[model samples]
Target chain A: MTNRNNAVNNAQKSWLYRPENHKKLWWGFGLILAATVVVQLFVSVHGHFGFDGWFGFSAAFGFLSCALMVVFAKLLGYLLKRPDNYYDDDA
Target chain B: MLELIFPPAFILILGAFLIGPIRAPLRPLIVLGAPLLTLYTIWQMGDGIQLTAQFLNYEIQLIESSPLRRLFATIFAIMAFVGGLFAFRQAKWWELAAAQAYAAGAIGVSFAGDLITMFLFWELMAIFSTVVVWCGGTEGARKAGIRYAIMHLVGGVLLKIGIEGVMVHTGSIEIQPIPLTNIDGWLILIGVLINAAAPPLSAWLADAYPESSPSGSVFLSAFTTKTAVLALILLFPGQQILIWIGLYMIFYGIIYALLENDMRRILAYSIVNQVGFMVCGIGIGTEMAINGASAHAFAHIIYKALLLMSAGSVLYMTGRRKCSELGGLYHSMPLTALCGIIGALAISAFPFTSGFISKSMISQSAADQHLMMVWLLLLAASAGVFLHAGIKFPWFVFFQKDSGLRPKDPPWNMRAAMVLLAAACILLGIFPEWLYRLLPYPVDYVPYTASHLVTQLQLLLFSGLAFFALLPLMRRTLTISLDFDWVYRRLILSLMNRLICLLSCLNTALRNASNRVFSIIWTYIGRHHGPEGMLARTWPTGSVVTWVVVLLTVFLLFSIY
Candidate 1:
């Protein structure tokens, strides 16, 4: 098992899989958020409705809707999901 | 030379036949060359019924050219070329042949000017696509292929019935935009909707598509639903019922896709979602809206195929398709990762992608019409698209907790095909004019305005944020979510099984009852007919004489009366 662990460590030495490189990925995400905010300040937004004109409306809406969607999907998954091989018996 | 002009669809159909006989190494040349030649032929012809033939009393318009038809046919040809290139090494020659034939049917439908011609090609598509699904060679593929075939064949029958009815009523077979007021039109709309993967029956797309082989899925992605969208644009534009149906389909796709586990099934559900945008655009039915639907179809074919190709590559390399079982593949397969992220971005309508240029037109039209509710929902769905397809696909497949599987990118041809499509997506997004010029309507919209860009970025980027923030909830599971196909695949099938059992039981009971009654009658008959019975025990001569005297007395009384 120790030898297998060593083998895995060696195989995972690629730049992306390195433990210390995770910070860089998080920083990239942070930069995207910062850029979105900066862009909002520069460009005029045209909103179709009253609520849409509020500052960060798109950001809030995008985040909230997606969050809700994920939650809903998780709930739905409980009801609908079956084992991956659910249809294998029929076949 | 003018008379010698043949329909481009025929070229593909002929190529389908030719592919089988060719030697293995030479097959790619034919597969790649045929679509290029067909594309050249498509460009050679000018507008208005280019080829016609007589069928009985009707003049069948086999090839029609308008910007709309040309746009669809062009994308289809491009798809065939790219799809064939991607699959040439991976797919069996027979699968390749069926794919070519399926593509021909789409091209044929695109050029078909009359309902008869369209129906003929429609069934042609149905038949060949089933074969493509069956090419997966899994038992699941066989069963799913049958279901797919049954669904599409039913759609085909409805379409044929509609066409016959319309012909009998209107006395013309010409393809024209008609309202859904009449039975004929409604039947046609339902038929087209089924192919579009609209509600209730929409489950067939997700049910069958993911069951196909990796390369086969790429081909399967392009042809059927897009052709159905073309049919709707032609036949049922501006119909109000479609607006509601389209909205239902969009959300249905998003939710179902969100719940999905298989990598390709997610993409399949999103196909319904993407086509929903096109369907809604057709519902809007403005020049801008129709153009949007057409352009979106063109853009969608490329990106969706690219996305499926990426998924196909993973499946090819690792032989695992469930998202729960895949991760950290980006480390080993950088090209596949890059191409897939590009596809996911394009699907989300990121700033400079094919989807941004095409899908926005529909929403803009909604805003232009002051459809506040529709615009808002479309906006929400745009973000939802990111949540389900855009982020869910790549994050889980490539970036989630490492499944510790290290598989390399696919072969050169597959990589080349993906790069080609990804490049097209960006090029079209940056230079929308190239695509705009080919649209049926004149170009007037700009996709890169400051406000549009900023708002789109916020919507997409924030959705990305949401995806990461909600990552815990989105953990992949070793399961599949049920869809409406369950009614037929499980519920209805079980119901039929039970009914058969009941029927057999009743049949046995009735047979037993009849046997008992017949035996009783036979026994009664036997009792009297036996030699030892009263009649056989020697009748008395005295009784016979008494009976004769009584008979004589009755006869005398009758004579007197």
Candidate 2:
């Protein structure tokens, strides 16, 4: 049981520490943001501005919203977290 | 020549019972043969043939022969066939039997010509799907299955109410497009939306789907939501509200997939995202958009199955589902990785894949309608799909940092299933004419235009780039993020706790009040009837006589007065 816990901890920490994987992940995010900006610019230059502007705003806003949700989840977990088997049959 | 017997889901129902009586050696053959026979029957009933029968004063339509219905049913049958093949080895008899029954329900739903028959099949699907989840034989799976059943049963009840309302108000249960203005229509819409994984109830899907056995998830992914899509197209084509809801689901899926650490859960969330595209198409409600929804449903099932098969294989081989724990598997599981990548590409709607051919029609429809914002957001979502599912899935599972795990490819049956689906995904993308001919609409649209291909390539590839760029934001953590299920699973739990606490307090107060009343009664009785009291035992007889005389005298005096 201790070994299992340790393994899980190591895996969780590794997701954060790994550099090459992190680089690839961030690169993907960067490219999407860049593309969205480019597409918005193209649309605006072509005088198709309102829809494109809203689309770009929504994309950025959606990302922000998702990030906010993660933070909110973490905060809520602190209040709610209990023993893993708090409500299990044995407990 | 014997006339073609078109029993829509008869094979599955027969298979379910037959499996119990038959020898185990022949069970797989029977199970696989059932769905194949269903497909054959569906094929035999060519376009424009409608077969109806009556049951319990309700009109039951066995076959509603249209290109769309045929296409959905065909895929369902195919799903059963492949899912059976995949589950042949280790899935218990009960699970296989339940799966066949569930497949029959899907086929029944697809080919139903009336709402009543659809509802019957719908509930059956619910029951059998729960059985499939329960067959996982784990506590988590059992709990998840129950929750899943509750959601679907609720949805089913709502649907039945709607169907009855439509029957009463409209005086027709013929399965066709109905206006969304009236109460009955809205009920039907809500019922269908619930199944489609619309908000506030959508979490039941991701919650329940991943808990099923790995093989079961593959089957679970294909049928229920897509059948709802088919129903939506038939019933509520072009309802504009579906656009926003679908858009919500699209992003909801991507963000959840990003945060999800469980591999199957990520795919589960991605199912909602993929269905979102179909729902959005239905909302757009043009001939082209409806076609897109139908075609995409057809293609999504195949590719999604392929993806799940790959994921299931990984889980089967290594018994690992978390991305954080899995990495550098491409060395040992090369075929699985390749199949997974193909599924990912197909799902991402990359150029020259199944997704490219099907998803583009919906986007094109949105563009045509000049729903410019809808178009652009959808385009961004297209990119997001590639970033999240396309790159994230394979990257984490097959090519991440080595965890020193050396699991081999899955069993041959599993690999065969994956290969078959992968081949179909490519075939549909490359030679879409066969699929096109099977659409409800006449084929006039071209999927291989340079501009269309270029734009899609640009959007998806760029999104892939963004996924890499935003690596910091996309790290997998060992936690579950909140979804619509929180409304019931968390919020309701807290509410129940509060309610229980309040009830206990009230019960204590009630108990005290009752105790006080009982003590007062007891004190009166002791004072009136104990020894040395007015009604003591020694003089009880005489005293009682005197008391009776006194009471009679008092009563007589009162009457005289």
lDDT values for all models = 0.90, 0.83
Q: Which stretches in model 2 have alpha-carbon errors above 4 Å?
A: A1-91, B517-561
TM-score of chain B of 2: 0.92
lDDT, residue B209, candidate 2: 88
Looking at the true structure's interface, with contacts defined as alpha carbon pairs within 8 Å between chains A and B, what fraction does model 1 recover?
Answer: 0.82
The numbered model that scores best in TM-score is 1
Per-model DockQ against the true two-chain complex? 0.72, 0.10
TM-score of chain A for each candidate? 0.78, 0.53
Relative to the unseen true structure, what is the C-alpha lDDT of residue A37 in candidate 1, on a scale of 0 to 100? 68
Model 1 chain B worst lDDT run, 10 consecutive residues: B529-538
Each candidate's iRMS in angstroms?
A: 1.2, 6.5
In model 1, what is the error at residue A55, expressed in angstroms? 0.9
